[model samples]
Target: MRWGEIIRRLVLIPPTLFGVAVIVFVLLRVVPGDPIAMMIPPGATPADIDRLRAFYGLDQPIPQQFVTWLGQALSGNFGRSISLHQRVFELVLARLPATLELALLATLIAVVLGVFAALIGVQLRGRRAEWIVDGGVGVLLAIPDFLWALILLLLFGVLIPWLPISGRIDPQIDIGFHSSFYLIESLLTGRFDVANALLHHMMLPALALALPFSALLARILKTSLAEAEDQDYAQIARARGFSRPEILLREVFPNALIPTVALGGVQITLLLGGTVLVERIFSYEGIGNMAIDAVINRDFPLIQGLILTFAALFIALNLAIDLVVTLLDPRLRHG
Candidate 1:
């Protein structure tokens, strides 16, 4: 059943991408912005503008433009950016790792904080401490990630100035990177100092991006844990002389985590989306920051490429989450 589902999703990928491509292509054209005008100098002639439009294939009718772009994109050629004057694929690829690293770090922080909070909630169930925990979670949830970004910027970047507020790594480090995955490459090559510097720069932004999601995970996991504790398996464990901690660790926690893990996967995609604004605030050199640049400059090719990439990632993540949930739940696997 799982394999069949996976295959079905895989079959849907092409059409999914096609739909995303068509929508973005049309919407970008519909918006009141001329890529050629943005590219040309103020004194440029109408002839120059026409030539530039012809060069970028913007002179074609909308349907023809879409058809041409679709063919090129199908062959993995996403065209060049108007503002950046670089291939869209190359630009997106260059920045993708930075966004991915930030997302992964944020996910790690969120998961740890969430799990710890949930455990605390379980331990302090029905007590005054529980109210405190719930209140804190509520506050965290009330604020969106971007506002958290600004607050963290003001707090850590201005007054205290303990951490680097912008960029992925210090410009002074001058370390040679083999690939764009600076943190992983640094650690693999035993460059602990480089890795440490990267983390120092990333920590605040990642934390800002993490807090809301962590609060959400905490709420969900706490509920799941409370329910799991009242289940027959938990009762049986208690009757078998298991301590609260032992039952939680050995039985109830795993059951509770199944749902939390599934939800975490969905939140990760949202976290990725949130990075667009958060990255811009922190001046992080990720695709999200690039995305903002693309939008502002009306870089049609880059915008379409980035949105398509995001859509593909969302679909893949959803499929992977389904597989993971199935594997974790015996009923799903066996049924």
Candidate 2:
């Protein structure tokens, strides 16, 4: 990418973030429930409620409140959680690792499986094998990812009872001052046993998140691969006695991958959104679950912080994807 284009995209990030911040701030204030009301204890007088509201600065006009909050937010101060009484930023950071780990594992699974599936679908086009793959993709896409989580939970957690049903690791294991990533910490500490347990616990949730993403990616890549297969260079390469696999590996796959990389940002957003459901079902203490709790308790600061964090992540991931796509396809660098 040209320096000018890179600079332009970077400049857009702040305005996008500000728009999201404004929307969340306004919508939360307009909603029915009062955060102060939720915090008030039983038998508390009106004066007590007023005092609490004023203390949190909720009594201020909406415009003033938004300006104040936005200013604080720019400085990385998201204020205290109304319910938890802890710093919103701190709570989010604590839970962030689990969400990132789950998202990374899910994306890895999706990319690997999706690419292979797309290759198979294109190579075996019009055959029973391709049809079967198509049917499977259709099935996966038809169902929501959370339902997949539930099905896996039922099959493994209920029927087989093989994998641990809930949580990131066994409660019995006390990993001291470790990194938030369980497997990494376990490996670093030379506790192979704990690492093994962490992997086992993670598999089901990761699989639950991966299935739909993989299916979507496969469908997109399949179309791209098929189109690339008919391109002039691919036909020319075939005419030159290039093997089928060579033509695909050299010419088609890379083109297919460009579109896949672009689609990957959307897939990641889906995975992040799906994390809320998956984390809840698995009882995983990730940011998704924390966001859910924040919403339920009407914790405005926590909710604001979570939404902003998610928005920033989504923007960053898309920008990264654009850079990757540009690198993979040199034409994008100039365009």
Candidate 3:
């Protein structure tokens, strides 16, 4: 990537984050529920209410509150959750890894399946094989993640009983608090049994989360691959006596992947946000589940922190994808 692009991405980060902060701060406050009212004991006196409000800084003017929160946020302080009574930063960090693990596993499944399916569609062209792939993609895309989660739970958890119905692992295993991330902790502790068990437990939930995204990616990839195959360079490669597989592997795949990379960035945000329902269904202890619980309990600080973190991650992923695409495609490097 050029220096201009690098500088541009860096410059946009602050304004984008500030916009997110402003929106979360203002809209959350504007909502009907009062955190102080929710936090205080039932039948508490006006004096008690005022004291609690002042304690949490909710009595201040909205602008001053925003300024105070923003300053603390910049210094890595997001305030304590009214519901959980824990620092918002620490609360999120604790559960973030579970969400990351789920998201990464789902993305891996999606990309692998999507790319291969697209490749098959491109190769088969107008044949029944291509039609089959297209139809399958359509069916998968038609279903939402939560529905998939329920269906998978019923099938694998109830009907077949092959996988554990809920939770990240069997309670018998003491995975310990050595690392916040379960997978990493398992590996570091040399607990292969726990690692295997974790992967097995994760499969159904990951597949549930991944299938729709894979379908969307497959559709995009098939179209892009077909277009790439028709390009002059692909034709030139064919003229040079390269086989179909060689042409696809060497020439078509890279060009076809550019749009997929961009779409994948968008999918990252969707997958992360959608994890709330999926996590709740699977009984997975992740930030998405935390967010859901926070909402139910009226935790404003926790909600703001989760939204800001997710927004920041989404923006950062798009930036990274843009840089990757620019680096991969020579045409993008110049313009």
Those runs of model 3 whose alpha carbons end farther than 4 Å from true positions after fitting are none
lDDT of 1 by residue, 207-240 (tens): 9999999999999999999999999999999999
Query: What is the clash count for each candidate, in the order shown?
Result: 0, 0, 0
Expressed as tens digits, the lDDT of each residue in 18-131 for candidate 2 is: 999999999999999988878789999999988888877899999999999888877989989999999999899888988998888888898888888888888899788889
lDDT of 3 by residue, 1-335 (tens): 78887898899899998998899889988988887777788889999998888878999999999999999999999999988898999999988998899898999999899888899888999787878889999999999999999999999999999988688888998776677788877878788888898888888889988999999999999999999999999999999999998999899998888888877668878987888999999988888888888888778899999988888878887788888888877888987
- Evaluate model 3: give its lDDT: 0.88
> Measured by TM-score, how close is model 1 to the native structure?
0.98
Ten contiguous residues minimizing lDDT sum, candidate 3 = 175-184
Q: Runs in model 2 with CA error above 4 Å?
A: 187-190
TM-score of each: 0.98, 0.94, 0.93
Error of 3 at 113 (Å): 0.8
Best of the candidates, lDDT: 1
TM-score for candidate 2, please give it: 0.94
Q: Candidate 3 versus the native: TM-score?
A: 0.93
Better candidate number, 1 or 3, judged by lDDT: 1
